[model samples]
Target chain A: MMNYGIIPISHLQLAMSIILVLMAGLVSAFLKLGLLKSLIWGTIRAFIQLSLIGYLLAYIFQINHFILILLIMLLMCYIAAREATRRVNVPTQEPLLVSFLSLTASSLLVSVIVVTLIITPRPWYSAQIWIPIFGMILGNSMNGISLALDRMYNEVRSHTAEIEALLCFGASPWEAVKNSVRKALRAGMTPTINSLMVVGLVTLPGMMTGQILAGADPREAVRYQFVVMVMITASAALGCLLLIGISYRKMFTEDLALTEDMRQSHN
Target chain B: MEVFFQFTQITHQFAPNGPFIHASGSLQPGKALAVQGPSGAGKSTLLRILARLIKPTSGTVIYQDQNWQAIPPRYWRRKIHYLPQKPVMFEGTVRDNLKLPFELDLLGKEGSLDLDKAKLLLTEVGLPLASLDHDARTLSGGEAARVALVRSLLIDPEILLLDEPTAFLDTETGKKVLMYLANWLQNKKNRGLLLVSHKENNLAFFPGMQAVVIQSEGTRG
Candidate 1:
């Protein structure tokens, strides 16, 4: 029973999810929240949501529905955007909108392109393959955009004069921000890069390890990780590009000077 | 050819709920305008307004015969630079910071000084030519202030706004910085300075440079 694959993975995930919700409830209790209510409410929500998602995924795998796969892809992006919005510093909220747009457009484009053109999954829009793969891609892209937005905003704020001075002198807004932009992009992508480097050597990634334990051949597991990692990297890159380009306007004026709202929000 | 900047009835209040910190004042260009006041006075605010770093609550800043409102701010910003009470040290080398004022797009299009002129300006301020090759973060306070001043002037802006540039310097260093500025203003015959300082001796350093004691407005004590 311990060695069994899907059962162990599901049990572990359930336990971990329960523990996290419990911890959140406990923390909320100390903060004078309705602790018992949240604990019960949160556990139920997670169980239902995950159970429904699990059945839905099974249905998707059997049906191989393209429309359903696209919908799921979009849903993942929407959730990712929501998560990212909770973390950024733009007070007026255009930055949040840009983040959402970037996450949706970039992750979708990259996932579709890579999955279709490169991986060439049989049936092309196969839901079983697309949903899980898109999930990883969109999730990481969300993290990337969130981190990049936070960094770019902070950098622009603290170095306001310098950035303006650069713009005044002749640097295009993009050129003026090339340093910060590159740094933001690098910051957003670094974690994924580091995790990819250590994945098989340090610890098997959840998906690959799950598949291997579920009796898939080691070679097959490696192939899937290879495809997933490439997809994730592509998604992260596209996400950063979209975020920087689209959100660049919010940080600067039409003249491309850094704005006061961006500068003073932290204070 | 004419005045570099003109401030007309410019006022700024830092706190929306607080009393007006800066009453309106009209200042002409090509003349030294000294902003002297108590700590809470808006000397810094006024200077920032001239630099267009901070917009005034009311009134206008005219530069090069056109009102500041009409000009593209980035275009005006190219010609305007403010030295804060504490100038920020941008990351990287000393050469990096000194080279900054030149990096403005305006300088690139209209024209900018070569390295030799920059070195001369640095030397006049008593900063070593070797400073141009080192990191900015390592510099002492007085040294950084001197560097900030030199860099601001390097852009050749018609109007200059300085806030407590000499605060961190000793008597000798402060005088040297002031004297260099006075000489530069005289040499250029047009570029004016709005300096905010408390040092009485510093006032004497630029005789031809006009002075205004803001606290002199009221408060007999």
Candidate 2:
């Protein structure tokens, strides 16, 4: 059987990619974009997690088990929910669980539809294709959820007076939370929008980079990246929309107030 | 008249060596506390604890004979709005700032957004009705501070705990805000106000007003 792992050249590229990511992180730390410890911990966690994921994928590819693939994707999504709540100042379990449920459900359906009806890959559980694509989409959703939650919590605390005004005037907690939720959704989706706005013009995206590196035709790579971009957009939109639109009511009480301790819950 | 607000046995240390470490005092409600300490003396923290924004290390704060913690913080916060020493205004129109807590979510709702309420608050805070549409970021320090205060008052809490709310305002603006607050609190319908200020203003403005000096020791951030 042919090798499923990357070529030697790809190994070199991966090493360089890791180094560059670390460097970029260090620079941001120096610039105080946020806490330095956060970057350090994030890098360490990402490295260990991704490495384990790499080994797991290799094993998953050999088995070709649909149940295993489904199970792994669910696990990845569970971790993603934890990530979404990591930096938030709100109670994470409910929202994080909600976000994870939506991300997994939507991404699974979309990926299944795309791969089966559209892409038509042989052996539907082909780890090579479904895994990478799901990784990108679910990862995007994680970041989107993270930003949305942080923004939502902050907006609530900062605008207490305005919130109270609404509550006093007979606005339900949902009614009170409406503005903050919208702002959070907007804030979370901003990076996606900007990337979409400047894609191809600003930078070649990750998918395109991978395709080009794989020695695919430039046109083929562009097409793949285009499809992937649309998928990502759909994924991110669906994740945010479902979580923001549908699940928030369960997070808070009928009075529009947070149902539980909305604090960061000690990291 | 004397300060009615009281903070008995209030002991707070934000951090081991941080400034504003030690503070203990009492101010009769509806009275002003002129925190005249060099740099920091736990004045803000004291105010924060009273407002239920921060909890004290160990102490009892009797707000009408009710343990501050026993009451829901939101209820206390609703009645006792905390205005920090520095005013932080959000990014939006003056009207947006006034309606900020609801604008985003109430988009499709019926009759929740009230323009009239916003204008009346602006006027109450001494801003013209036209200022409602003014950009929040473009407002001067004095204007922002006033808007911030009005925003806090929007909740209609029964107690006002200001932390150096007038530190950024011009003397004229500061005087006006102080006067308005004094007059508002004097009305039996209004809640008691515990204003934190350092400027030289006549203490006799409020009938039941007295100043509690925050003694600054080495314990301050």
Candidate 3:
């Protein structure tokens, strides 16, 4: 058995981390960037949020029950869905439902595959493995879904005349908005695809860094990181595809015309 | 007189508290129904409803002895094409734009593009034959309008719901478009026109054309 000793951080060491934020604050103040308040607020919020999640996760791991794990995942998904829907500026019908369905479907599917097929932690539904993996998948998928929804709506709104023209030419709603949907799906998936291209060379992704810092073998961490990268890419692609598939119909009326609301430009 | 297309008691309100606009009219085959009204009196809305592009609050449209609802919207729209005031050009050549309708699953091979007919129409509309390959997005307003009209004609609609078709063209070109439409209505069987125009003189080109005036009947009581 390989023994990699985990370095423990003291409360004093954690307290001293404030010095890094203070350095950023000094730079902001010198430049009159007006971001000092946001910096301070962000630091405080991050501290509280991370601390609360840490204690909650510790408790969850200790309980190690399947139902409790499921409930926590659901709660996380609901919050993520709300956040995703809030990011879209275009008016949509039942966006919360769409976002929730997309995130839950894609994130849950990816997480299940990762845990069951790839990682295969003992007892399969082990809370320690499930919760964090699921959380990461949900976070990335939520961002992808939000971006896709926003892009689709804005694209539809801007292309109302073209779409209506297609409808006049006997295009089904799907056919009419197909170009916009392509553009939107491209917009949604581009970031993840681009990150895939430059993953190791450009930036060290968060999960791999965390695992390495926590004293996992570098080779083992690399393997986990590769799984996570592919998992995230799959979740984002699936989430965007699902979101656009279900939500494209909202841009049209039952009569197969571009919705009146979509016709009016969003000022 | 045989009525080819008839819509009765068509009503719509743009907003919840807005005034109600009432419209009723019948179009005869081989003739045109000129939808005339003040700028904001829902003339375009009337044509839109007939085109099935917008649903009227309450109304019934009958076409060729069939209720408008009986036909699917895609078929209805294909048969009763609505050309808007501002022409929309897709990201392609005029030839591609002309061939667009046939690319739709609704048309399949039944409505394949007739390139010879397209070139003829382009010439009749005063565009050079070579203009067919010109980028659609680069066409001037008048050119785009004519291309849009030709595209609609190629689809072989029974009735055209033209909203300000001449709005972008100069008077001579507008008259040419009107003349072309006049010839179109005469040359084809089962063809009709529902034209919305701000310029009454534009209506003059379609001789013996009947008129339907839409009016707002004050706020809802």
TM-score of each: 0.83, 0.60, 0.95
lDDT by residue (tens digit), candidate 2, B84-110: 665666667876666654443322233
Cα lDDT of model 1 by residue, B115-148, tens digit: 7888898888888998987788889988888877
RMSD of 2: 9.2
Runs in model 2 lying further than 4 Å from the true structure: A1-62, A70-129, A136-227, A238-267, B1-6, B16-36, B91-96, B99-136, B150-155, B165-173, B213-217
For candidate 2, give the lDDT of residue B167.
78
**Per-residue lDDT tens digits of candidate 1, residues A86-177?**
86756774766787789888777877887788778788888866777778888888888888888988777777766654654445677677
* Index of the highest-lDDT prediction: 3
Which scores better on DockQ, 1 or 2?
1
Number of colliding residue pairs in each model: 7, 24, 0
List model 3 lDDT by residue over A53-150, tens digit each.
89988998999999999988988989999998896755647888888888889999999999999999999989999998998899988888888888
List the global CA lDDT of all models.
0.73, 0.67, 0.88
